[model samples]
Target: MSRPQLESDVRSAYDEVADSYADRFRSIEPEEAIDIAMIEHFGSLLQAPKKVLDAGCGAGRMLPVLAAMNCDVEGVDLSPGMVRRARRDHPSFTTTVASLTDLPFPDSCFDGYFSWYSTIHLPDSELPLVVDEVRRVLRPGGVALLAFQSGTGTRDVSEAYRRHGHDIVLERYNRTADQVAAALSVGGLQEVARLERSAVSPHERDGQAVVIAKV
Candidate 1:
């Protein structure tokens, strides 16, 4: 499918289940200890009161995580319903409806970029565009942390939502840590650290990978 079509599908799917999604995943769970640790490490790399953008921050669940690290964080998501939920649930921070490939913010405006499971929907051919946008908005010496399912191809992730009584088709694209690091490098971000772990929960079907890079 085309990028536009894929994005539209994803937006619609998330919109249809925004409330349920927010209710189901209100916080980072215990199973995500390693992922949270990486995010904490990413926060440690930045100075206090750092300006951070939570790119594709659905429901704004992770905003408080950044806030706890003394980062001034705002969020943007492609789905308006998700943004609405974010604004309602996390009113302390500003959340906007925007796409990662075409952010509305100015250049070099952020000190950190966090994309937790956000880029999983992007196809390999389009990952660079989003990474370039990240590079565009990050200041010199800024850091970015990306989390996604680690593997080699796409998977149909619509079943979980379907179980919640929502009829949606969601496809998540998986990439190896090396592939993600390479894309980050091509977009002018230097890889600093990476972690790849096997799935440890019954809810998870694939290994997880987190890549930390600096601009």
Candidate 2:
């Protein structure tokens, strides 16, 4: 599929289920100890007053996590419905509807960046564009934490929403840790650490890979 069309379809699918998505995540978020630990460690890299961006931050889940680390954090997502839910659910937190490939922020604006599993729906061919954009906005010595499903496939996943009765499905891509690292390197990020583990949460069941890098 064309990039623009793929982007539009992905955005619309998430928008269609934004409310339920946020509600489901909020309930299960407390059980995400491993993700939280990694995020907390990422936050510690920047001191108070340094800024952070939660790229593809659906429903502003990372707000309080980063807040506890004493860093200013803002979120952005491509789905407008997701952004609206984020604003409604976390009134104090700032969020906007913006694509990862074309961020609205200036160069070297953030001291750290977090992507979590938000990039799962992005096509592999376009990953480099987003990575370069992330690198462009990161300050020197900044850290970025990226998480993805550890596998290879381009699958359309509309069947999972049957329980919710939403018939919502969209195309998603999976990659190996080496693929992610290579893309980050192409974007000028230096690899620092990596973690691979069994997927303990319901949101994803495939093996998970998390990579830490510095700019």
Candidate 3:
């Protein structure tokens, strides 16, 4: 499928299960301590009163985490329904409906960029463009944190939502830490740190990874 079609499908799938998704993942879970630690490390690397963008911030779950770190955080997601839930759930932060490939922000405006399990929907061929857009919106020395399942190939993740009574088709494309690091490097960002951990939770089907980069 084309990139546009893929994006549309992702948006629609998420929109269909926005409420259930939000209810299930409104906060950080204990199983995600390592992942949350990586995010905290990313927040620590930044200066005070940081301007952060939570790219593809579903339900704005992590917005509070960033805010607690003295960050002036805003969010953007491709799904309007997700954005709406984000705004309703976290009214203090701004959430907009926007695409990762085409962000609605000015150049070099953010001190930090966060994409927590958000890029898993993008195929390998389209990662560079999204990374380039990430580079565009970050200032010199800005930090970026990306969290996703680590592996190779795609998986049908729609069953998770189907179990909650929503029928949606969702495909998640997995990539290695090196693959993501290379994409960031090509987008003018340098890899700063990376962590890959084995899956521990019952819901997890693959290992997870967090890549921290700087522009």
Candidate 2 residue spans exceeding 4 A from truth: 1-5, 27-31, 201-203
- Alpha-carbon error at 119 in model 2, in Å? 1.1
As for lDDT, the candidate ahead, 1 or 3, is: 1
Root-mean-square deviation of Cα positions for candidate 3 versus the true structure, in angstroms: 1.6
Residue range 129-180, candidate 3, lDDT tens digits? 8998999999998999999999998888888788889989888999999999
lDDT of each: 0.91, 0.81, 0.90
Q: Write the per-residue lDDT of candidate 1 for residues 67-184, one digit (tens) a residue.
A: 9889999999999999999999999999999989999999999999999899998888789999999999999999999999999977888888898899998889989999999999
Better of 2 and 3 by TM-score: 3
Deviation from native of the Cα of residue 215 in model 2, angstroms: 0.5
lDDT of 3: 0.90
Q: After superposition, how far is residue 95 of candidate 1 from its true place, in Å?
A: 0.2
Ranking by lDDT: 1, 3, 2
Off by over 4 Å in 1: 1-5
The per-residue C-alpha lDDT of model 3 at residue 140 equals 90
Question: Model 3, which residues run further than 4 Å from truth?
Answer: 1-5
What is the lDDT for 89 in model 1? 96
Candidates ranked by TM-score: 1, 3, 2
